[model samples]
Target: MSTAAEVSQNNNVGPVMRQGELAQAVVEAAEIDNPDKIIKVEDKVAYLRIQTSDEMILKRQTIEEMLGRPFSMSEIEIELASFAGRIDTQVEYIRFYHAKHL
Candidate 1:
């Protein structure tokens, strides 16, 4: 059994990414969300852990806008090492959040 505080503490969500250009783009895109969020990026030699509290969203459009080129959301998978929480992927955006919160 878990208390509210436990749930809150475990609510952090994001992706562990393979290091390189793709991971860099994803991390940059995460920082550019409209409502904005505090994102934490940890370098782990071969990979990077990118996380935010409660929820985080990355838009294909935003990624493209940042890169100044055509970008496919699926391309992210190439760099994704792992992810926390449930993922809702759309043509326009990808979201990570706890199912219980939804």
Candidate 2:
């Protein structure tokens, strides 16, 4: 487990979650994606910080698969303690990334 300070100091970007079933689901979804970007995970006693180089996405269907139950994207807001990138949510997925200007 990393201290809050250490997690914040990280230059990576992703979602932070409070400990619970939802947190577990997020981890599982990330593993399934296995993005090319470097991903870092830090577990704090009551919170978890999942970081990636630039972008990450977690789909509602994937979470449902991990949880063995139906899930709504809105549920993420309940466990989302914080985040370090731009967030885009749709009916099927949530994406975290730093936006690039045109």
Q: Which lDDT value does model 2 have at 52? A: 80
In every candidate, how many clashes are there?
A: 0, 0
For model 1, give the RMSD to the true fold: 4.0
C-alpha positional error of residue 88 in candidate 2 after TM-score superposition, expressed in Å: 0.6
- lDDT for each residue of candidate 1 in 1-102, tens digit (9 for 90 to 100): 888866656667888999888788888889987356789999998999989877899999888887778998988888887998879888888998886652
Off by over 4 Å in 1: 1-9
Q: Write the per-residue lDDT of candidate 2 for residues 2-98, one digit (tens) a residue.
A: 9886765544667899999999889889878755666678999799998886678889999999999989998899999999788898989998887
> lDDT scores for all predictions?
0.84, 0.84
> Model 2: residues >4 Å from true position, as ranges?
1-11, 100-102
Q: How good is model 1 by TM-score? A: 0.82
List of clashing residue pairs for candidate 1: none
